[model samples]
Target: MKIRCLIIDDETLAHDVIESYIKEFPLIELVRKCNNAIEALEALQQEGNIQLLFLDIKMPGLSGINLLKSLPKAPDIIFTTAYPQHAVEGFELNAVDYLLKPFSFERFLLAVNKVRHKIELESRSAAAQGYFTVKADKRIHKLNFEDVTYMNSIGDYLKIFLKNGKVIITGETLKSIEESLPSNLFLRIHKSYIVAVSSILYIEGNQLVIAGASLPIGLKYKDQVIDRFA
Candidate 1:
């Protein structure tokens, strides 16, 4: 899969150089190039499938580092900047690599190679994994997809209910868990709840009955839920 990329920098020269380097690889697709973080934000809002970002730390207005922090689910980042001092901060933000300004095309390739490996690993894991792992009570827990009855969001974590009346509370967002689940087997009936399509016993109005628990279907999701189970 071609990695969809966005380049955010203030320098025209930087944009040209990065674009040139990216063009050498058929696996990289440069989606948009922005002169500042604000434009990058606009681009991100408009396009949800952007998988990678080439960001410059010291932009004119909102800095690239701040923009990354603000995103709810930021994509993989490679920080390209003149200031080597920002390397620590960039890595702290989980950037795949830091490219110093005046970097060689060879250096750019090395950085992107890391991104490609990361993408490959994520794709492999998502496609092959049958269970989700979580850290709870100072220990690791694995919840198999087949055992999951429903999932509910509780503040920063998710409360996952099992078919055998077991509950596992973990620091996982509903959105993240939903993305990991098989879409054919799980139906997101509400913003806060995702129920196993097979475990659903009945639907009472806008609520779904699963494993003897009633979960409300959000108004925005009601129609889709009904259509799926109808």
Candidate 2:
């Protein structure tokens, strides 16, 4: 599979270096290059198929870290920066690898390999057991898709309600989690809620009942929700 990649960095030299290194990997496709966060954000919004991102932490405006925060669903990221001080924060944001500027081609290869391995493992796990993994409460949890009753969004975090009457709260955006879910089994019925299609009991006026809880359907999503059951 070709992994579509976008490079967001201010330095022309950084872009050149990365593009050169990417040529060695037949599976990595360089789709776009942006000099600043604003342009990168536009590209991200316009392109839905980007699988990986090469981002720089320090930029003239709208620092890379802030750009990452703004994205509702970010691609697998590998931070390419000159600053070592931001390493901790980069990893905290779930960066696949933090490559210090002037990194050798070998180092770049290692980071890209990690992304390949991660995608492969997730694909295998999802196909084999219908499970998805998330990090929450300082732990990584492997959860069965069928056990998820519904998910509620609370700012930058999500409260995932389960069939076993338990909730898992994680620092993940609703849009991000929705992208990872199986579209056939889950439906985003509102801006703040995503329900397991099978868990939905019935539809009331502008609302749906799932696991005995009533959740309102956003006006923008009402038509899609109705069509789901129609």
Candidate 3:
């Protein structure tokens, strides 16, 4: 998926220059451009999925630094400004890169590459830790692979059974969930059921015992399940 981006700057010329530079990157999609921090804040609250920000440090009302501070969780930022003094402060806020005013297209490209690299590293780290986020009950839930015992499908929703006896209902399909889960940790034994490979206690005939519950292994999946153990 393309990285969604937002440009927040008071100057029309700054917006034009950034937009022109961004067109060279097919992977970056500019979603919105804001004149100031307040407009950017409103856009952020409404969209909630912007991945990258081209932020100017100094603006008329609310400075970009203050805007970043106000956000509970800010997206990856690349500070663009005329003043070089704020570069130190921006780095303290974990900005990917800082570009001074009248920056060349080459410099903008370099900064964008840094943002892409940072995002890639973060994704790899999250995957390595076996952590995934899912939306449930109007909130995002961060779950670990070890905490999930199995998943059951009911119509259009999925019921995720946890080791602690708590079930989370999410409006997601079994296939989608299966694709997101680590194959080495989770195994699809049936069309409607996916069990954690480490949680399997035993297999008897065409059924597998997991978390003290017996779950069926589909006829077509039985061979693969046996092969997994073999």
Candidate 4:
């Protein structure tokens, strides 16, 4: 499938440069070019099903982040910016890449290749029957139906708290981790946590102590949580 892409840069030269660069590959199709994020927003509405966006962080009406925020469903964004300060913000939003203004085609290709690799993984994940792999700093952590203890959300990462006190930080969100973990072993007791029924030490009122950490038991999950241990 062709990856439909949109470029939202304030500079005509940058647009032309990207247009030239994309010509090397037949998989990427430039859908539209916008002067700023405002124009890009309107174009996204018209294009409907775009896969990638080459966004400039500093624009006239709406910044790249502001544009992404306004959209109900935003496509993957690769920030094309002159400033180096937005790198932290970009990763926080899970941006695919961050391209400096004077970047070369080689650099741009590297970023695009990363996006392509991500798309391939996402495609595989969609057809994935049940299992999913989580990555920590050094290990390719596997979450088999049996090995899972539970997961807890801490910012963007999830803490896979096991029964034996081994904890792993996965680069996935709470929602993704919940879907991949076995429902019987892992129960989401709060918006921020999912715990193993076997590992739960005890419950007091709305407080749940697991592995010596006090996690609040959300009112909605309280009954199911108690029933899990019962």
RMSD of each: 8.9, 10.0, 11.6, 15.0
| Model 2: how far residue 73 lies from native, Å | 2.0
Candidate 3 residue pairs in backbone clash: none
- Per residue, candidate 3 scores C-alpha lDDT tens digits across 1-230 of 35668999999999999999888886677878999999999888654346799999889999999999998778899999999999899999999999999999999989998888876776565458786667799998888988999989888898999999999999976765664665567777887899988899999998899767999998756755777887
Best by TM-score: 3
Q: Compare the candidates by lDDT and give the number of the best one.
A: 2
TM-score of each candidate structure, all chains considered together: 0.59, 0.58, 0.62, 0.55
Ranking by TM-score: 3, 1, 2, 4
Model 3 scores a TM of 0.62
User: Which ten residues in a row are the worst by lDDT in model 1?
Assistant: 176-185
Clashes of each: 0, 0, 0, 0
**Cα shift from native, residue 195, model 3 (Å):** 19
Cα displacement (Å) at residue 29, model 4 = 0.5
lDDT of each: 0.83, 0.85, 0.84, 0.76
Tens digits of per-residue lDDT, candidate 1, 138-229, equal: 88888887788888887888898888887888896776666566555677777788888889889998778876788998875675577675
lDDT of 4 by residue, 98-203 (tens): 9998889999999888888887676566435445688899788765544445677788887886556688887877755554544444567787877766667889
Reference-based lDDT, residue 109, model 4 = 94
Candidate 1 Cα misplacement greater than 4 A, ranges: 130-230
lDDT, residue 115, model 2:
97
Report how far residue 149 has shifted in candidate 1, in Å: 22
